[model samples]
Structure formats: structure tokens, C-alpha cells
Target: MSTSRKKSRKARASRESSKPSKRTIYTAIALVSACAVTAVAIGLSTGDSDDGGKDATAATGAQPSLPGALGADGKGAKGKNGKPKKTEEPWDGKVKVLGDGSTSYTGPQPNQPKAEKLKPGQQPPQFIVFSWDGALQGDDRLFSHFRQVARDSNAQMTFFLSGMYLLPKSKRELYRPPQHKPGSAAISFATDPHIRDTLEQLRGAWQDGHEIGSHFNGHFCGAKGGDDWSTEEWKSEIKQQYSFVQNWKTNTGYTDIDPLPFDYTKELVGGRAPCLEGQKTLIPAAKSFGWRYDASSPGDFQLWPSKIDDVWNFPLQLLPYPKSEKQVLSMDFNFLYNQSGDSTEGDPAKYDEWLKLTRGGYLNGFERVYNGSRAPMFIGNHFENWNGGIYMQAIEDTMREACPREGVRCVSFRQLADWLDAQDPAVLAKLRGLDPAQAPDWKTFLK
Candidate 1:
């Protein structure tokens, strides 16, 4: 590491030490079980609520600022005063329906930018991956809403689809989650209509260049949750995720609906474990299925990513809580937990304030990496409308403000891994060595 990097680390530690200890990061995760009921009772449950709203996949450190504004005409950043950007190209190949006709093989995914090796001394683009867990399209229509948001912001996100969402409740017994009864699940199974809507969103999301990764089946957490699962059990879970997605047609018995526009087995490259637990075994289980990345880590600082057991470990980062010396995890549940304790329905009066803080926290993280180390920002969220849907609003606003900025690429985990793989190992090593806020001399750094 360079002198600047050393100073940056020291400054970060000092700032952290100065803050009054409120809640420990692990404590934040442990508190999820208490709040799970609120998310579920609201009927917006994505099946991960029982595990604290699906993958807090987060940790604490640093902060971010400045909200952005954009329109939703589907023109992306290029049509406005914002920076010029690329848009998705239409797929030209004929679709070949795959097994059981639940999914099909469209050619290569559209709107994907080719991952090119960075030139020596060239500055890295700030990368932001906005990933969703339990990607179910309930009555809220959030799944479709964010898809439009991505198109308007020149962004492509990762939707971590829960396998149970594709498996109708009537066919629930077919799902054999390890350690749990064959038909039992922590959260509610998707209603048939919701499942149909979710399937539509999944089809369109992939066609629009978004990545469809797994959030695994049956959002189990804590005790018998992912945290306690053995490697073999995790492998069983992984296989079932594939099984549910690939055989949704068989399970749903919907003859009128078209097959999903991509082969899930081939398209799946990574996943975030429910409640961000069980990653120790999850990593090996994921790797066995040729996964390229895993976003199941509980927490880490906002830094450049590194591989764990050769699989890209994309942990949710901690960001500075706005206007405070303290930091919060980058996921919505952490923000919700901090603001209202275990209750999802906090002070309605403070909704505006909470939303402001949440947006600021994300922007603070974004601003830090965008202006500093250019480390990739990985933000995890669900589609629930907790706390009057403030978290959802905050994320949408952040996307508009950040995605269209110069030298920023709002992409998916698979895309990030692709870009990382395209770089020289030494270059990546040097990049990862710098502090999150340390902007080094690029020429010498790469040289």
C-alpha cells in the first residue's frame, strides 16, 4: 500500500473509534428475526422476511451524500443533460424453448457491455451493483417498477429470484428444503397471480439485460436457517433452486404463459444467501454448480472486491450514516432497524427524515467510491414497502442520481465479475490494496 492508503486507513479507524457505540454490526443482523413478522403480516412478504427481510447482506463503515434527479422516459442518461451512456440492444436470435418449456434459450443477453481489460494507468470506472432479494412481484408491482427505473437510469441490476416464488403454493410439497419439512417454508408461498406476475417480470428483466441470480429456495435463517446448514445441505438447497426455476411450467401448470426468455441453469452465475447466513458452506456449494460469485457475506467495508475460495465474494458494504460519525450497513433492513428498532412501522412522522437519511447513506457510499478509490458499490434490497416504502424511494432516487454520472457503471454482480476477470491479476491486486477513500496516482499504481 502507498502512503496515502496508509493515511486513509488510519483516518477511517480514528473516525470509527470516535463514534459512540450504538449497535454492533452483528447485533443488527441478529435483530432481524424480531422484525420479520412485520414484513410478512403486510402481505408483501418475499419469503425472506422470517430471516429479517431477506439478506441484510450488509456491514457497517463510512457514509455517503448528495441526492440525484432523473426522468423516466426510457431514454437513459444520454437524452438528458446527464452523461452519455449506452442502452440495451434488442435480441436478434430466434428463441429456442428449453426443458419442460419453463425457460428458453435466447441468444446472449442484450444491453451487456463487453468487459474489456483496463489499460495501464487508466482510472477505473465506479461500479454500483443494485441487487434485489426474493425478487417476487407481489401486489406492490415493485419488480416491474425497478425494471423501468433501471432503463431510465442507464442501469442493469441483479434480481436474486427466490426459487419458491416460481413454485406455486399448491405444489409446495415438491420443494424439499434441507432440514425443514418438505412443504414447510419460513415465509408465505407466492399466490398464483403473484407467481405469474413474477414470472413475467423475470422474463422481461432478463430480456432487458438485467441478471437473474438466485436467492435460493425457502428463505430460512437463524437456528435451522442457512447459518446452521451443512455443505451437503447447502448443495441440496442449490440444486432445488435450479429445479424450481427450470420446472416452473410443470409446477404451475400454466399452458398459456410463454417460457422465460433465458435458460436459468446457464444464466445463473451467483446468489445471495437468505439473511446473508450460511456463506461458509454456501460458497463451496455455489462453486460446485459453476457459480462465479456469491453475495452472502454479512458485512464488510466499501472496498474493491476479492475472491473467496476462487468465487467472487460480493458482500454488502457498510456506509457512513448521514451527518453522523457512525456507519450503517448498505441494505434497507439495517436502515429500517436503526431508525425504528424491530418495528417496520416506525413513526409515520419520521418517514421523510428516515428516507432522507437512507438516501444520504447510499449516496455517501456512492460519493466516496465515485470520487475516491472507485471501488464497486454493492447495494442489497428487497421489494417490500416497509416504513411507508421509504427505502424503495431512497434507492430509486439514488439510482437516478448516481447511475448516469460520468465514469459510473450501474451493473450486476455477474457483470462485475466479468469485468474483474478481464483485468490483469496484478492490477486487481493493486486496486484492492488501496483504501476505500484513497485515490492513488493511477500511472504509478498500475505501473
Candidate 2:
């Protein structure tokens, strides 16, 4: 459906479109002293969530300042030059309330480009997906910051919300986490203020036309975590994830705030498994829930996405490391681990070195696919300031540099799946045959 990059993006804008943290990097680091560091360590070490709003900031030992939500007021805030900072208007779609009025059916997502099959000999556009795990609205408000970044960059993203974010600590009893005792969770429970902030941000994100996927409940990892969950256990997790989103009003007793703007039962589609574990059982279990994709795997060579159990599998890709023969997984925590070892707060002197490494790795991976296979690049990140907010900077740099290029489309996983599903299978197969960094011989490849 996309033709010229600029033209197609405008067409989609004539169509559809779309962060973490609840705190500043400094406050985030300070929060670590208050127990967030421990929380983040457990999550990051397990290979899944970094708990971006609160925990990620602690674990990464990052403390970069977050630009407060761009155009945060929705009426559109102004810039330093005294000009209005541009932002898309909120969707004015039809809405219908759901259970306890915690969620509602907003109309078909606004600005969402309709997916259409490729022309007989069309070249595939470059595709990139940026995603967040544990979408928390902690004191840093990283969630809101990135949303603004997306809007400003004309990009859309997926926020794999941890269901626990909606279930406040006081009401933690309502949770029945799989493979663990009820109320038990791998990540810390949210405070009342954080919950309220998170709720507002979530509502704003949907209204902005981004996709809302689940990061599941509890964030369980390790020997008794999601890795150990049975099919039924995953199902139980999915159901509870739904329940929390569906009944946040009842769960949190927040009557004044508006419910989420989309029907979650229908809106919830796909997710990345926490710690990138349990796909063997979780994929099939997700099938029953009618999810469209799963992004639980740790790494892949850049490639066109494929499906298992009829659901899309969007794994993170391996990227070239600047100074090492070893490639790295394309997520913030991995980069942090590689650079700082076990320390979230590694040598502050190496901050710039880490930042450059982080950015270079992503750019190397992206250009490889952009000029070659055109397989979508998938990146997973937390709203973390780990290594001096390098990952976040890298993402913004990617958006600024890539999205405006000839045919690059920085999009949500759902949008990518829609395009993939719309393609001819033979063409997809041919496209997949191109190596990750192998430039396509388009004339022959497409024919």
C-alpha cells in the first residue's frame, strides 16, 4: 500500500498513527536506593523486563533527563521558540463503555493506514519496530516522553503493558499469578500515584493510535517463572491480564479518571514473553486468545517475520558490536550487561563510550536491512536511562535519521503484521531469501 515514503506516510496521516518511566534519571537512580535497583536487577538478569518506569532507571544506573511529555496538555504545548509544538489531535472515534467502565470501544484506530497487497513489482519498504516492555508511568514519565517522540517523529510503537501496572499494591490480593502463589510477583507492585499516572498515560497512548499489547501479568521469570508456565498457566495469565485492564476502576477505585479508550478484549492482540521465555507453551496458548503475534524470542538475524500457530513471531535481532567479534541482542538490558557487566551503575567515565556503542550497533543493523533484505528491524527497550540514557538516545537518533529516508516506515508491530499478512506468500518467500545484509537484486528478486 505504501508507495513513495513521504506520500505514503502522508496518506497514513490522512489515516493512523501513535514511553515509560514515571521519573527523571536522577530521581530514578535515587529510587534504586529505595529498592528499585533490586527490582530491576531481578527483572534484567532474568532476560525480560527492565521495569522501565521505576525499576529500569535503577537497574541501568542511568539518569538522563526525560523531556516531559511532548505537547503533554493534548491542546499542544509550545516550544522554546514560542511556536506551538505540533502534535496530532486526539482520536474522536465512537466509544462504548465496558465492564465496570474500566475500558471502552473507541472506533477503528485513527490514522491507521489500511494494509494493501504490493503491486506486481513493488519494492518492499524498509520496516522498523520499536517496542517497550513493562510500560510503567513511573516518576520519570518515560512512557509519555516516548509517545511524544513518536508523534514528533511520525512513528508508531507497541507498549507491552505489564498487567500488574493496573493492579495497585493495596489491591494486590486480586492477582493470581501463574506458577506462583496468588499476589506473588517477580516485579514490584505499583504505588497509588504511579498507578494513576500510568492510567492517564495509557489512555493518551491509545488515543494517539499506537498499539497496546500485553507484557503479561507478574513478570515472572527464572525456574518458577513464565519459563515454567504450562499452557493453562499462560492462559490463566492472559485472562488475568485482561481482567486488570477490563476492571481497573474496580481494582483501583479511581472513579473520576476516564477508562481506557479501547475494548481490551478486542484490543489485546500480541506480546513479547517476559524474559523472552515460554514460547513453546505460550504461543499455542496465545492462539486461543486470538492474538495476532508473539515477540518473545531473544534474538534473530534480521529477517522478514514469519508465523507459528498462525500468530506472527517478531523476535529481536542480533546487531554488530562496535569493538567485539560477538554480536549482541537488540535490547537495552543486553547492551547494559555487555558494557557494565553486573553493575547497572558501571564506570560513569565510560558513559560516552557506551552511548556510542549502543547507537552504532542499532544503526549498523538497520542500514544492513535497509539497503538489503528490507526485513523489518525489531528493537526492544525499556524506559531506562541505563548507561546515561543511551538506548533512548539511540532510538530517537534512529527515528530522526531513518523515518525520513526514501522508503523507511517506522511502525508498530501490528501494522507490520498487517502488511505482512497482505503480501503474496511467494513474494514473501523470495523476500525472505535475501540475506539480512544482502542487497536485493530487486529486478530478479521481485519477478
In order of appearance, the predictions have TM-scores of: 0.81, 0.80
Instruction: List RMSD in Å for every model shown.
Output: 12.5, 14.2
Q: List the residue pairs that clash in candidate 1.
A: 62-319, 62-320, 63-320, 63-364, 64-364, 64-365, 65-363, 65-364
Instruction: List ranges where model 1 is wrong by over 4 Å.
Output: 1-94
| Candidate 2 wrongly placed segments (more than 4 Å) | 1-94
- Write one digit per residue (lDDT tens) for candidate 2, span 282-314: 987776655778988655567787878667888
Q: What is the lDDT of residue 157 in candidate 2?
A: 89
